[model samples]
Target: MKTDSLSAKAKTRIKRPPSEVFAAFADADLMSKFWFTRRDKGLKEGETVKWYVGSDDGAFAFDVLVKELRKPERIVIEWMGQDGNPARVVWTFEESEQGDTILTVEESGYAGSNDAIVERALDSTGGFNQVVVAAKALVEHGVEVNVVADHVP
Candidate 1:
């Protein structure tokens, strides 16, 4: 697989409407069901929200800056990357042929040495891959995959 890159994208078809899928992301409580364990607040334009994640080791938190928000359509946010660099994540919601939501997530701004950048990019790509799949299970089947938490072990 191609590794060395500054950005990565993951797309998935969710058997739900755009609004429902969007709520899975925009609403902090719903997001905890699939991705981060919890957050300080829901997403809002011009605001930075703290997202806490759980793992076998313990829990850690990160800040996600909501750069843009467009209801059941799109959202853009910037999260901290290497040494204060900001990595941008853009999530888009599209209506599919069956009236379901086509969710797309793209993250960029991987920075550092050649190997460092590639490693970070690969992790981000893989992480997002797991996230969307977990989200699909929760939103479509109401199953908590515990994906991110189980990533290490």
Candidate 2:
């Protein structure tokens, strides 16, 4: 029940190999199926990709900077608004004890005081929770999850 004033982490269990799940993220086409629909340049070290999400009515613009990229294991990216501030999402992929893959999405670096950061953290938590779930569905069951459902603003 924590809010956005502080950072938060979301986790999901996906019944897929780490490499496969990782592919769903590294590949732009694969990523579009579960996450943002729009396709842009793929992520690479020292590369920043811009995505034009959804229609003009609900379009959101953001930049993703690939900080660390390791195939089928981990990906660390910094996401931010046009002003280059707001949130940073770090996605970690690991194999679980049951052989399933676990994806952990952590967001930190919010602009504001401790109270304000924790309050706004809710917004980030909700987005990443949905994203991780969507990743699980798309990779494991071939189902697509709509993150915009009941989305406020």
Candidate 3:
């Protein structure tokens, strides 16, 4: 895939250490508290996890297979739709100069120049940004940031 075709990048800095920030993704409980809408199996290298989005109405879902798991650094996973084409998510954790951790989530591999792909990318960017902020608030100040309140006008 051409790099130029990729969508815009979203970056967020969390006021937590690398381990804490990384654990926010790897730990199922922590992830459910911040990112994932529901709980599933624990995250490990070479494990396949499935989770749904909506509650009772049966909405969109994703089946992700863990590809790479580098502790406190990076996690790479393949996000496939029900049809199983090709979607990807790369989560990276970096140590900042001020002793904070920067988490960068890069997702790509949407089919072609489909308008739906653009919408999905934008929605994912907003969700990830909110999750990062929530994780930061939880880890640093022991408070959870309500993203829906912030996102909704």
Best by the lDDT measure: 1
Structural similarity to truth (TM-score) of each candidate? 0.88, 0.83, 0.78
Candidate 3 structure quality by residue, lDDT tens digits, 51-144: 5453334645567789999998999888763334477788888999998888888877766446666666676677767777787877778785
lDDT, residue 74, model 3: 93
Candidate 2's residue-wise lDDT over 1-153, tens digit each? 343436778998888889888888888887877677546656787788865576365677567888889887888888774334656677788899988888898888777555667656776788788888888888888887756543467
Candidate 3's C-alpha runs over 4 A off are 1-4, 54-61, 81-85, 146-153
| Best candidate, TM-score | 1
For model 1, the stretches where C-alpha displacement exceeds 4 angstroms are 1-5, 55-58
Residue 145's lDDT within candidate 3 is 62
Candidate 1 least-lDDT 10 residues: 1-10
Task: Please list all clashing residue pairs in model 1, or write none if there are none.
Answer: none
Which rank order by TM-score, best down to worst?
A: 1, 2, 3
- Per-model clash counts, in order, read 0, 16, 0
lDDT of 1 by residue, 54-149 (tens): 733457878888999999999999999746767889999999989999999999877667777777777888989998999899899999887766
Question: Model 3, residue 25: what's the lDDT?
Answer: 75
What lDDT score belongs to each candidate, Candidate 1 first? 0.84, 0.75, 0.71
Model 3 weakest 10-residue run by lDDT: 1-10
At residue 41, candidate 2 shows an lDDT of 57
> Per-residue lDDT for 36 in model 1?
81
